[model samples]
Target: MLRKTESSIIFIQQLGRGLRKHADKEFVTIIDFIGNYKNNYLIPIALSGDKSLNKDTIRRMMKDTSYINGVSTINFEEIAREQIYKSITNNNLTELRKLKEAYHELKNRMGHRPTMHDFITNESIDPIVIVKPHKCYYQFLKRINEDISELTSYEQQVLTMLSLEILDGKRIHEIILLELLFQNDQVAYDDYVTTLEQLNCRTDSNTLSSVIRVMDLTFFVAAQRKNYGDTPICNLKDGAFHLNDDIRRSFDTNETFKDMFLMSYYVQRKKQEPMIVALH
Candidate 1:
């Protein structure tokens, strides 16, 4: 089909007409010209009937056409694949309407509100992206008018910090240390190093200290620090690290916030890999 279509349903409908049986018709050759379009990523989603909305899944589908079943085959030129990859990477999946649609779709499927873990497990848009435009997921929900509990200012601040700094899963040291503190309330510095060693993560002093600085907001510039209220989530004492008392109390009292925070960690844990440090 030579027609350009933005909607997967319309694209499939157009292709379906050409696949219909006809008298004396042996085989049909379909050629789709992929121009410089931003929605080129939808080609695989339409072909595979996949609604995961994950870029990696779409890329894998492009690489392997075996999912089509039977003797039918599909192929893409190298340049076309590159174009689709660019489209997938450059398209903003976190647009407000798109986010709302993804949220409600999952919510309807599960018969209740979906958590960050739900989004991760469903292979929907990354939860980190969902929380990007707002202060946190809670704020996003509020923007969509979902029924959610009200958050105190402190609770909002903590969630905002977690969303902005740690939810991306880029560097996971802060997540590891925070999880340790949540489990034990306090963790010795030596024990923390031992934990990293056991996990095969980098245990150098510089890396370890940087983790603490990030959690305590010392790693950020002043302008960036203002976004998180210029407060530390953890404290370093003589020989150990401790979760801030107010944050700890909030974690204990606010089950919703605790669930969201732990859900973020769970999602990151699935995406986490051992940190590789170079020796100079």
Candidate 2:
């Protein structure tokens, strides 16, 4: 018989492999296999990021659910107890106390059932390139001098502006412009034009579209566009132009790079969000 920890780890490794096989993308998330949460017993972990319990972890403890869709019935209580046990076994005294305190601190917080993290463990692919581009990235933007550097002055400005706007994922051109001004709101075309002028980039919608098109053609960026609201939005992919601190650090440190690389790859895979194309 396998030890509980060993059993749970095996389950996790299995699920990890399953996710990799199921999804075209390398990174995996709870959302991919969450069609039937309660029956599947993957709900809590998907919702919460608690490290204690997760679907695979629970699966190991219970080994009951049929990984089939259209199941006829389920013994919810039995699985629920398995989830509760995992939560109890996984945590230390301090966390247990916190869980209990949180239970009473807010009435119905537990919702007559085990909490989210109690049922599932929250796992994520770590970041790839860890870059603190704010300083060096922006310094390249501060000076407008044209001839004395590696990246052209134009490229530097655009890259800095892009870094400042997006924290985790990519956005379309209009969305990027909108963020620079209204930040998640609508901005008059005039204000947007002024901002672009100040940056030495053209404000015309057509020119901006061309810039994106050219970048994609050159492999300087990879983007996927989708419709959002009444407008189209574009998002960047984990391609060459994108720079991440975690990824950069991994490459710099010979010893830690492999592990960090996997983690960063995971982060990039997880962060992909749906976006609309930029319509000129």
Candidate 3:
């Protein structure tokens, strides 16, 4: 039940098995099955890239990329939360601290980060010790900046709207344009005043025009104008607005959106909203 320095050998072994050339083989297909299939810090680690051991490198790689699905890490469910908490607290961190150190050493020594369950299985500790209570092991990861943070509420909402915009191709621009006005990111004129009036926001045409100008510096949306130098909302040529090409491209493959979606899903299971306990 205890085998230190075996993970690295297994890692190399698996790849070596598939890497053997054959006429029937098209290419080497490496599939790492993992329960905690989330986050991107391990991308460079998997490829054995430069700065693979550096947390900054991982964060930079994560941010610059489209998305991360942690295929190499195993995620454990909370089973004996109370028992784990009790064990560590009663021990006064002597054993806990040692395990934490081992976790780091194992990562470097094993050539890959090992899961808490993996540690429990390979070491003389209870699997439930780090499996259940989140922080016992979380603090260890935080020391190394290997912890994955959850998403915020506003960011999640933005992603929802963005995803909807993508699915609703015909109305994406029109929907977001209306959303700009709804969010007060854009201004409307006489007809817009009518829209605001419908919303019970009391404002005259000139005041609305001024407000629109003040808030029109949108990064993802642009308003159309009439040839007569006036904002138009009724005429397709003058009133319709469009989404920026670059912003749309970013939305197509944004890691932030994917992270938020997963975090929201996780939180929803607990009956508490995601951002109620956001990561930073």
Candidate 4:
């Protein structure tokens, strides 16, 4: 098959036409001559029928097809595999057009506006990709002209900080402390370390201090600080960390802002649970 089609569905349909069984045919030889196309990465996505938009899964399917349910084989030349890898790396999965398409498709499937949690639960495109282009999911909805509640300038900046930095689940210390503060209004450093220990996370002094810095925006570079409006999510005083007064006020007064922040936190916590289990 000529690898000229940009649509994965069309590519898969073309491949399907040749896979029909014949009276005398034992098997069919399907040859795909890949070209230097930007969407060559979609070939594996089509063959594997994986809609996760996960590059690693695509790469794994290229490497091994033995786990496939049917008695079929997929072979890729080393050079061709490398070409697909390059395409996956260089292609912007978070481009506006792609994000909009994914959003609408998933929205249609659910018969309603899909939340970030809905995407995660459905194993659809990575919600991070949605946030990358617009800094938060609501902003992306806004860009697509979805009628949603508007966010204030301050609320928008706070969401940007959470989406860009905290919600990636690189480390859960900040999230844990933030959740604690939300529950109790303050968290002692000792209590924070104890909580990390209970979760099997690194409780080293440096790691603890780093979490504090991250929450207070001290860990970010000047440019990043400016992007987040130089706002601190937490404030430390008397050896206890408290949510920043302005932020806490926003959360207490604005139900919409509170809901968005808590939803992001819940998603991050869910993402970290697997790592926490493995640590034990």
Candidate 5:
């Protein structure tokens, strides 16, 4: 039998086959793709891509519960190709042809594989989970998602970003912002303004508004606009958001930021689904 990770990759390949066909046909060359993965679900994102496939659209599409499940990423194209070819070589020719067509569609839509930066940002990872033989991997993943629904999209984004920062030790805003922007270099004042608008945050200026919303009183001290000559400028709390002892300490010590929310999400999920274990 394939490993859990391999099964996840296969499932993603299947889903990508369907999505890639309808996706816009263009090579979205980006500095990075801010992909988020939880359990088996991999949300591959292209920041500032075609307007229709922008961040907001991707977020909304992912909110659809159906597509949110059984998603994963395979970062190695050759590995993906090898897997596909090996599977097809021994399978029925008709099914092989169909799989090939879908594989081509995915290749055309998403290009090759994701970069190393992509894995770090979204916390897309392979963490081992202990389970009984009867308990399928997808079932375990679904349970994990069910345990974390109280988290808003903004909150989830913040958590994932924080997770990455913590994993990387320390990260800069310009670097983070650029990673978030991914494919686009020409960021304007409006980009900041729009992110704030989506989150319904209030602030004195566009410069610090989006930053304020992202930090959400959980991790940052402040984001403020200051004048730099004739142009508007903003400073993020410190030089950059540090993920060393201070930040990690906060997550461990603070209730509102981590433990309380996690407990609530987990407890409520368990209470509502008492028979889930038996069902599994």
Candidate 6:
């Protein structure tokens, strides 16, 4: 019996079978059969990451409905956990160059990192050839300088929590709390509360407030409103807690991120309501 390969590239390779470009067709269709086996649970683990494969992990992953459509789940707790992968030798240089070019070209085309499967579907290479090199996904992203591997473990956990799967699993209040972390890193306190209330989950405001405090200790830090003697200075007046300006800038710029952020912050602050702005 032909079974599905968990490798993202494998899916892409198979899609290559009879795949053709049609500008009129906006979607590609896949037909897969989920077999009856104790080892079926492991596929979720592979799709997830290097983390342990267990019932909870798979459950959370399946919550992400944003992945592929129409895929259903079995009773994960009842299924036996089995690791079903083998070691493969690295892909030759020619193969590596192909990968680099495919990814880079996609980045240029998409204006962001290309999903592995997208590369397989679009590139005219066999999916088997892509996976033969045995490189981990994280290794490939780092090689191309599009970084996700550098994320702190806390960030990864938050990402997992805020992912479409887990967010879809939780209550509306919980979803609002996580959405605070969308495109912008920081937001205002009132906006957090207001967004949560949009769904009429009024019971969560106090709890959500507490969760923000906990997230500050572990996943993020907050900037408090402060004072210089009697004068009010830089502080969060219900603003969102985020990676300080410096850290945020450091991710993209080489100039001392923290220092630059501070300088810029002060410059902008002074200019905002100033009759005259200067620094000594």
* Candidate topping TM-score: 4
Better model by lDDT: candidate 3 vs candidate 6: 6
Global lDDT scores for all candidate models? 0.80, 0.34, 0.37, 0.81, 0.32, 0.40
- How many clashes would you count in candidate 1? 0
Pairwise TM-score winner, candidates 3 and 4: 4
Q: Could you tell me which residue pairs clash in candidate 1? A: none
| Candidate scoring better on TM-score of 2 and 6 | 6
Candidate 5 clash pair list = 42-71
Give residue 229's lDDT in candidate 3 (0 to 100): 18
lDDT minimum window of 10 residues, candidate 3: 225-234
TM-score of every prediction relative to native: 0.80, 0.21, 0.21, 0.86, 0.18, 0.32
RMSD of each: 4.7, 19.5, 19.7, 2.8, 21.2, 15.0
- The top-ranked prediction according to lDDT is 4
Q: In candidate 3, what are the lDDT values of residues 63-176, reduced to their tens digit?
A: 344333443332222332233233323433234464566566667766776644344335433323332233223333555577554333433334333322222222112332
- Check candidate 4 and list the clashing pairs: none
The lDDT of model 2 is 0.34
Cα distance off (Å), candidate 1, residue 7: 2.0
lDDT of 4 by residue, 92-163 (tens): 777788778888888999999887878888778877777877988778888999988778887888888888
How well does model 3 score by local distance difference test? 0.37
- Residue-wise lDDT of candidate 5 within 1-280, one digit each (tens)? 1223323355445444545633565432212122222221122222112112122333343333243234433242444334433443343322324323433443355565322232223233211110111022222223434232243333333333433322222213233343333333234545654544454444356536545443433234333111101111122333332222333344555543454223212322333233433433
lDDT value, candidate 1, whole model: 0.80
lDDT of 2 by residue, 1-280 (tens): 1222223344455555635544456544332332222233333332232333323444443444443335222234554556555554554422334333433333244344222222221232111111222212223223322122243333333333333323233433333342442222234445556655654545576776554443333323323111101111222243212233332333344432333223222232233322221222
| Residue-pair clashes, model 6 | 6
- Per-residue lDDT of model 6, residues 92-117, tens digit only: 32356656775676678878765434
Worst 10-residue stretch by lDDT in candidate 2? 224-233
Candidate 1 per-residue C-alpha lDDT over 1-280 given as tens digits, one digit per residue, 9 for 90 to 100: 6677898899899888878989988777778888745799889988998765666677889888888887678988888888988888898666889889989989999999998878877866678777778868999999999988888877887788888778875766777787898799689988988877776778888987888888888998998677776788887899999888887787778888888777656667666642333311
Instruction: Rank the candidate models, highest lDDT first.
Output: 4, 1, 6, 3, 2, 5
